[model samples]
Target chain A: MKAYDLSIPLGPMHPAFKEPLRVKLKTEGEVVVGAEVDLGYVHRGIEKIMRRRPWQKAVFLAERVCGICSNSHNLTFIETLEKISDVEIPERAKYLRLLAQELNRLHSHILANLALFLAIEHETLAMMLLNVRERVLDCQELLCGNRVILSYNVVGGVRFDTTPSILKEILAVIDEIEPKLRRYAEMFEHGPLLRMRTEGIGYMSKREAELAPAVGPIARGSGVRFDWRMKHPDYVDILDFKPVWREEGDARARYMVRFDEIFECIKMIRYLCENMPKGEIRRRAEVKSGEAVHTQEAPRGDLTYFVRTDSFGRIEDITIRTPTIPNLGAFVKYMLRNSPTIADAVVIYASIDPCIACLER
Target chain B: MAFPKLVKIGLRQLIQGPVTNLFPKTPPVPVPREFRGKPRYDREKCIGCGACVKVCPSGAVELIEDPTIENPKKRKKVEFYMGLCIFCYFCMEACPVDAISYGDEWLLSSYDKFDSKLIVRDLPEREQS
Candidate 1:
């Protein structure tokens, strides 16, 4: 065995990644054979904090798991509380829930793709982030008055209502934004540098994808037809859309899958806008003492929340598993074959939109 | 590659305007009204509710109590530490008094950790009822 000291520390810095997860790569020559990740940097003891707070208040705490995936965490925690007491939210609330989730999916996936471009130092593509992200941010602000952390989802209902005016404004914003989005997607697909860098690189075979336990774009890229949206039909059954998947399992394939998912989300959002059911966005329900499991396919992958409530209105226990945990495994596998540069590792990691804070929680 | 096609790209760069603005050295480009940047805190409107303190996920806000005040509620103070602040703006959402507002001070940097932490007054005496 040839001995070589190849250790590179990625970051705990505020700029490198929003969340803190230090990537320590051991490379033999230019190939990374082994990788270890450290994630204690951003751990705020969210679970422990949740255990101390009331279950109702815990919804707000859980929603802070990550700014990009705020709605998903908000939904998961609320859904767990609803399940524990066997409370059913109103029909209209469910529709709004689906709409918010899909919008979040669109915003998160696009932002992730933009970040991947940023990591590879594609300034032209990276500059597009400001415009593309602004659309979703405007939509989020119009709807909930906040862009990054939308504190809309309450216990049994959402805080904001999709009034006629709000709906019209949302639709108008989407109309203005969609053309720019499509143009960027076209640019991404045909861009020479983008193609050269991402196409057939970081290839994860279907078997390898399944074996690695990655989900969302990582799994869908490998042709694994697994999506929590399909699995849990109750959440998205009424929404008229299908899960986006690709067989290539390369970085470009993952990027394309994300782009296609945005279109699907828009379709679902439009459908919800046109045919929004008439009912209260929230329902009155009692928070009971019991243990319950909550699961939702967040933008990245299956975000699971386990909650146990005490007789008092406070939460007894809370646990979360973010998508980054599984998707990160794919990097060690793929980077082993490539002449891994620091840039390559950064690109591969950014491609998954790894949220280390959520993982540590 | 064709020579004309190659020359066209090269010549265009020579004749074309600069791709990026030279900051500080040249005049700075004006940002839009809605640009997202650093946050601002207002003391007058603040009710000393401490909602901002509780809701800050980053533990960036610290409430300093004046020991000599007759009414402790009226003497509450706050200091913001940008070092730990994530810029999530949860404090703005959680503020009942609407004391905290988002500002355009994004170019924040400091050599010392203590210098980076901003000390903000939570609520002045006149604001208290």
Candidate 2:
């Protein structure tokens, strides 16, 4: 009997894959038969950290889970705390939270898709996509003083209020960003290099996509009309926007769906910015003894946060289930049969937009 | 036919200038006046209120009080450690005096681990213009 062995280590610190998941592929003659994802490098025991911190303080601390989806974690923490305490967030705050969360989605998906483009060797297209994404980053920095971690979400409401001046700056930025983004979209649609890399690559069938616990673009790209904003009308009621979907279950479809969603986010932000309610942005509430579960769709997928508060100020327990876990599962499944080479396997992995840091946290 | 075509492409490439930026040799790009970069601390205006230290998520800033300064009215020394900084700019935002502002210099790579630590010394009363 003869056996052939090959092990390709992806990253603890890699540019191609986000959040440092070690991809160990067992291949036989350039065809990957199996792949196992190992994660522990970026784990900071955030749940343990949350346990030590006070309930109110955990809102700020939890946002550190992932820089890209910081606002999502903040929303999750706030919603969980509110549920546990049996308090309703003010209508205005809810609107603002939804607005911030959607904008985060728009930016994160673009960044991830662009990173995939870069990995696939569509350098020019990647640059164009990233350049458009810079507008979103700039707007975030101007709004919250940071591009990724917009520590704007607080327990009762948001810390920062958008005044006319802030709105005007945001509008000016969106105005500058939209036309450039449109050009990129046109270029992406027509670019042969983009077509060559992504068109038929990483193709996951509809049946497989349905069985898998996919969320966000991963689910939507497969023609599955499942958006949290649709099922939960609070997001739509608060922000007033429709969900975007695409039918093709391929890499290019995911790219197109994300591009379309960017416009939807812009419209949502514009509406919320224009019709911001004149009221107290935050509600006055204190954490009490109870337990509650909060689930929200992060940029990647559904983010579940479990919280248990005690009589004292400190939170007793907190557990986070990131979207990347299920997304990684789908990637492993697809790559096992589809990708024949190490590069192919890597490309398939990148397409899912895995956030290892979020998983580890 | 192919040889002549290759020569023409090669000659065109030779005439076109290099794409690489002359980084060290040339003057740095002019940062816009309003552009925010690294945070620089002006110790004179700082009241040692510790607002920056409290708001820092990464615990990068520390308020070091000096007992040697006898006058109760005089402010104590507060040192800054930029090494552990997440560059969130919360310290500058929380500063009541607005003594700290963004600097355009972002070349913060240090050969020695301690060199990245930016410590501001308090100027004498005479030096305070």
Candidate 3:
């Protein structure tokens, strides 16, 4: 083998990544032979700060871990807290939380596809994806009062209740966007440029995917259907979702998985909203000493939060293993290892939907 | 062949026109009434319970203790530093007396971030009990 032809550093501050992360690629002319990802640039010590805060306040810290998937973090933190206290929230609250999480999933999947299209230099598709995403954001704002950092989930239950009008507005927004979302899926599947650019690019094998332990769409795309939702108590009963997967194990496969999952999200959201239970939004939650863990499917993949609470209900220790950490490993080892071109490697990085802030938090 | 897939969307876009505001020419779409914008604290209504200060995630709300003052009422002070506010409205929710509220005014920019108009402070005589 000859020495590498060139090395390209993709970012600590680059357009490809909205956050600070660096991927060093060594290439032999056009083909990437090796890649080294350097993280920790956006580490804000959110976990350390979370440990110091009262257990009630740590969900906000978790919400700050990732801007795009704030609902996932916030929900996972409170679910872990509830687990520690053996708190069974009300029936209506469960459906409401499910609504928010699925809406968030829809929002995040659209963003991932948008980023992928952008990587392919398909600006029209990316802009259209963003336009479609605004509907999800509006629905979230209607449901939870804020678009991004929704402090919607409290310990005993959700903080806000959806009136009939708000639910109707959410349905209207969903109705308006569903056709557009379908169009995006078709465009990604059959669009000559998108399919040509993404199909067969950034291939990862099932065995490699397993070893990297990539969860969510990456694992599913690789033909190893490992999703936390199948086993998660919160979702297993509520969301009648089947895992969306593809056998290709390529960038297109990963994007397709995300695209298909949005339909499931839409169905689940509509079901929850139409059949929503009427009850109290929340009850005062009190806690005592215990340790508990929560694993949930964030938009990226499996996010785990493990916590230990003191006798007085103060959080003694908290460990958050965000999904992107493992997915980042999967990106470097499975997808980007001995890959084709440097450009393909970059698209592969986006294919994993890496949230560096979540990883570094 | 190069631009084949986007033809349908391109035609749709031609029909829909642009989705953004013209800034100076047209006012932007209004935020929903439920929108959580800038936070404001009512000095007259605050009982100095300090709930907002404790629950504020960023320490945007502070209890400016007047150590030199003799009166217990005068010594207890609550300050709203808008600069640190994350617009999460945790303070508004945490306020025991419902003194903290979200104002419609979202823009709080100034060369001096600490401008007097930007901050909500209690006068020493505020709510003299």
Q: RMSD in angstroms, all models?
A: 6.3, 5.6, 3.6
All candidates: TM-score: 0.75, 0.79, 0.91
> How well does chain B match by TM-score in each candidate?
0.76, 0.70, 0.66
For each model in turn, which proportion of the native inter-chain contacts is also found? 0.00, 0.00, 0.48
In terms of lDDT, the poorest run of 10 residues in model 3 chain A is A334-343
| Local distance difference test scores for all models | 0.75, 0.74, 0.83
- Order by lDDT, highest first: 3, 1, 2
Predicted candidate 1 versus true structure: per-residue lDDT over A137-194, tens digit per residue: 7777666656777777776777666677777877887788788889888989998988
Alpha-carbon lDDT of model 2: 0.74
In terms of docking quality, model 1 is incorrect
- The list of candidate 3 runs beyond 4 A from truth reads A1-5, B1-17, B64-77, B121-129
Task: Give the DockQ (2 decimals) of all models.
Answer: 0.10, 0.12, 0.54
Q: Please give the range of 10 consecutive residues that has the lowest summed lDDT in model 2 chain A.
A: A232-241
Docking class of 2: incorrect
Which order, best to worst by DockQ?
A: 3, 2, 1
If both were scored by TM-score, which would come out higher, candidate 1 or candidate 3?
Answer: 3
Candidate with the greatest DockQ versus the true structure: 3
Better of 1 and 3 by DockQ: 3
In model 2, state the lDDT of residue A107. 84
